[model samples]
Target: MGKDFRAIFWKDIRMLVSGKFFLLAMGALALYTLYVNFGYVRLVELSMYKVCLWDPQGICVDGSLLLQRASSREELDRMLLEDPDGVGIDLSRGKAEFLLYRSTPQVERYLEDYARSLLRPQEDFKAEVLGAFTTEEKQRREITCELLFFELSAVGFLGIAAVLFREKGMGVLRVHACLPVRGRLFLLSKLAVFLLSDLCFAILLTLLNVGVGPGLAILPDVLVETVILSLFMALIGLCCALFLQDFRQFTMIYLVIAVFVATPVFLSANTSVKAGWILFHPFYHLYMGMKNAFFGTPGESFFYYAGAAVGIGLLYMLTAAAFSREMRDAPGGLRYAGKDVEKREEG
Candidate 1:
C-alpha cells in the first residue's frame, strides 16, 4: 500500500509540474508577498481617519500630530468634501463641534471618540494591553491571513481540479482501475500532495509577511485550519473533475463557486457588508477559522472541529464514489489495455 501510494504521489507531482501548477503557486506567493510588504503595509499606515481641525481661537493645546490644521472652516469643509471619510472638527463656536457626513451610529461614535482622543494628547490615559501585536504587525497578519485564505480556497482548489482534468484527458485514471491498488489510494495520493503543498504555502506566506516569531507562534493552529480547508477544497475539486464532462463544464462551476460562494464570504467577513445568512455559510466559518488562527485565537468549540471532520469524511466518500464511476466508464481502448495486462499475467 505504501509503495503504491508513493508511486501515485510521485505521478501526481509530475502531472502538476507538467501543468505548471507549482510555478503559478510560486508566482502567487511572490505577488502576495510583494503586495503585503511594499503595497498593503504602507497603505495601511496612512491615517485611518484624517482629523481636520478648524480651531481659529487656538483653544486646543498639545493636540495630536495626526491632526490636519485648517486655516478656515471652509478649508475644513473642503477637506471633508475631498475625503468623505475624514473627520472634521469646527471650533468656530468656541466649543469643539464634530462635523462629518452622517454614517451609521456606531461609526459616528467611533469617529467622535477617535477625534476626542486626539484633542487631549497630554493626558496619560492608560489602556489595557490586550495583545502584543503593534499596528504594523497586526496589518501584516491581517493581509497575510486574507491572502492565505484566498490561496487555499481558490488557487489550491483550481490546481487540484486542473491536474485531475489533465489526468482525465490523458486517460491516467482509467489505468488505475486495472492496477492492483485500492481506488481510494489514487484520491488519497492527490489529496496528500495538494495538502502538503498548501501547508507549505501557508507556512511561507505567514512567515514572510507576519514575521518569523509571530508566524511561528501561530503556525500550529494555522496549519490545523489549513489541513481542514485544504482537504475540503481538494475533495470538492476532485469530485468536480471526476463528474464534469469536460474542463469547459468545470470552468462554469468554478466561476459559480468563486463568484457566488466565495465572494459573499469575503464581503461579509472583511467589509462592512453584513448578511444574516453568512453565519450559515460553511466557507465563512472556514475563513474565520483561518483568520482566528492567524490572530492566535483558535476556535475552542468542539462542534466546529466535529463538523469539519464530518464534512471532510463525507466529501472523501463522495470523491471515492465518483472515482469508481470514472474508472468503470473508461474508454474501450483502456479496457483493452487492461485485458492485455490480465492476459499477460495469466500466461
Candidate 2:
C-alpha cells in the first residue's frame, strides 16, 4: 500500500511538474510579493481621514498639528460638505464640538471617538509599544500574510481543481479506479502536491514582503496556519471538482464562494465593520489566525483546532464520496445500435 501510494504520488508530481503548475505558481508568488511589498503596503500606510477645524476667537492652540485650521465657519462647512466623511470640529462657542455627516450611526460614534483621541496630547497617553516592529514593517507583514492566505485558499484551490477536472474530463480518474491501489491514495497524492506548493509560496511571500528577521520569527505559526488552510481548501476544491460536471459549473460555484462567502469575512476582519455571524464562519477564524500569526499572536482556544480538524475531515469524506460516485457514473447510460443511435450519438 505504501509503495503504491508513493508511486501515485510521484506520478501526480510528474504530471504537475510537466504541466508547469509549479512554474505558474512561482510566477504568481513573484507578482503577489511585488504587489504586496511595493503597492499594497504603501497604499495602506497612507491615512485617509482629513481633519478640518473651525475655531473663532483664536481659542484653539495654534501649535496643534492634528487640526487643519479653517479660516471661517463657512470654509469648514464647505470642506465637510465636499468630503462628508472628513471629520469636522467647531470651536465657535469657546469649546470644541465635533461635526460629521451621519451615514452609519456606528461609524459616527467611531469617528467621534477618533476625533477626541486625536485632539489629546501625546504626553497625556501612556500606551505600551508591544513590539519593536515599525509601522511599515507591520503593514508589510499584515498585507503579505493576507495575500498569502488569499492565494492559497482561493487561487491555489481553484488552480488545483482546474487541473483535476481536466484529468477527470479526459477519463483519467476511471483509469485510476482499475489500478491495484486505494483510490484514497490517488486523492492524497494531489492534496500533498498542492499543500507543499502552497507552503512554499507562503514561505517565499513572507520572506520577500515582510523582511527576513521578523518573517523568520513568525515562520512557525505562519506555517501552521498555512498548512491548516491549505488542506481545508484543497479538500474543498477536490470535493467540488469531483461533484461538478465541468469547469463551467465549478466557475459559477467558485464565483459564489469568492463574493458571498469570502468578501464579507475579509471586510469584517480588516475594516471597522463587524458582522455578528462571522464568529460562525470558518474562513473568518482562519483569516484572524493568519492575521494573528503575522502579529506574533498565535494563541487561540482548543476549539479553533478542533473545528478545523472537523471541517477538514468532513470535506475529505465528502470528496471521497463524490470521487466514488464519479467513478461509478463515468459510463452512465447505453443505447441500441441504428441510424437512430447515430443521430442520438450526434445529438
Candidate 3:
C-alpha cells in the first residue's frame, strides 16, 4: 500500500510540474510579498483626518501637531474648500465652532469626534491597544492573511481541478481503473500531494510576509487551519472535475463559487459591511478560522472542529462515488478495449 501510494503521489507531482503548478504558486508568492511590503502597508497607513484651526485670538493652546493652522477666516474657508474632507474650526468668536462641508450625518459625527480628539490629545480618547503589533506589522499580517485565503480557496482549488481535468482528457483515469491499485488510493494520492503543497505555501507565505519570529509563534495554528481548508478545497475540486462533463461547466461553477460565494465572506470579514446571513456561511467561518490563526487567536469551539471533520469526511465519500461513476462511464473504456483486441490478434 505504501509503495503504490508513493508511486501515485510521484505521478501526480509530475503531472503538476508538467502543468506548471509549482511555478504558478511561486509566482503568486512573489506577487503577494511584493504587494504587502511595497504597496499595501504604505497605502493603508492610518492617516489622521486633516483638522484646520482658525484661532484668531489664539484661545486654544497645546493643540495636537496634527492640526493645521489657518491664519484667517478666509484661509480656513479656502483650506476646507481645497480639502473637502478636512474639518475646520472657527474659533474667531472666542468659542469653538466646528465647520465642514456638508456630508451624511454618520460621517459628520465621525468627523466631529475626530476633530474633538485632536483638540484634547492629552486625554485618553484612543481605543485600548489589544496586541503589541505596530501599524505596519498589522497591515502586513492583514494583507498576508487575505492573500493566503485567496490562494487556498481559489488558486489551490483551480490547480487540483486543472490537474484532474488534464488526466481525464488524456484518458489517464480510465487506465487507472484497470491498474492493481485500489481506487481510493488514487484519490488519496491527489489529496496528499496538494495538501503538502498548500502547507509549504502557507509556511513560506507567513514567514516571508509576517516576519520569521512572529510567524513562527503562530505557525502551528495556522498550519492546522491550512490543513483543514486545503483538504476540503481539494476534495471539492476533485468532485467537481469528476462529476462535471467538461471544463466549461466547471468554469461556470468555479466563477460562481469564487465570486458570489466568496465575495460576501470577504466583505463581511474585512470591511464594516455586515450581514446576518454571513454567520451561517461555511466559507466565512473557514476564512475567519485561518485569519484568527494568523492573529494568534484560534477558535476554541469544539463544534467548529467537529463540523470541519464531518464535512471533509462527507466530501471524501462524495468524491469516491464520483470517481467510481466516472471510471465506469468513461468513453476511454472502449478505446482501451480495442487496444486489448489488437494485442490479442498479434498474439
| lDDT of candidate model 1 versus the reference | 0.87
Off by over 4 Å in 1: 53-73, 90-97, 102-106, 119-130, 331-347
Name the lDDT value of residue 176 in candidate 1.
Answer: 78
Point to the candidate with the largest TM-score.
2
Per-residue C-alpha lDDT of model 1 across residues 1-347, encoded as one tens digit per residue: 99999999998899889888889889999999999999999876645788899999998878888889999988899999999887899988888899876466547877887787787766753223468888888889889999998899888998899888777766777877888999888999999999999999999999989999888999999999999999999999999998887788989999999999999999988877778999999999999999899999886489899999999999999998888999998543454467768889999
For each candidate in turn, the TM-score is: 0.84, 0.87, 0.82
Q: In model 2, what lDDT does residue 67 have?
A: 67
Which is superior by TM-score, 1 or 3?
1
Please, what are the lDDT tens digits per residue for candidate 3 over residues 1-347?
Answer: 99999999999999999899999999999999988888888776676568999998988797888889999989999999988878998888988799978565647877887787787677865424578888887787788899999999999999999888877766778878889989999999999999999999999999999999999999999999999999999999999999887788999999999999999999999866768999999999999998899888896489989999999999999999999988877864455457768889999
- Clash number for each model: 0, 0, 0
Per TM-score, what order, best first? 2, 1, 3
Positional deviation of 207 in candidate 2, in angstroms? 0.5
Q: For candidate 2, what is the lDDT?
A: 0.82
**Model 1, 113: alpha-carbon shift in Å?**
3.0
| Order of models, best lDDT first | 3, 1, 2
- What value does the lDDT take at residue 305 in candidate 3? 94
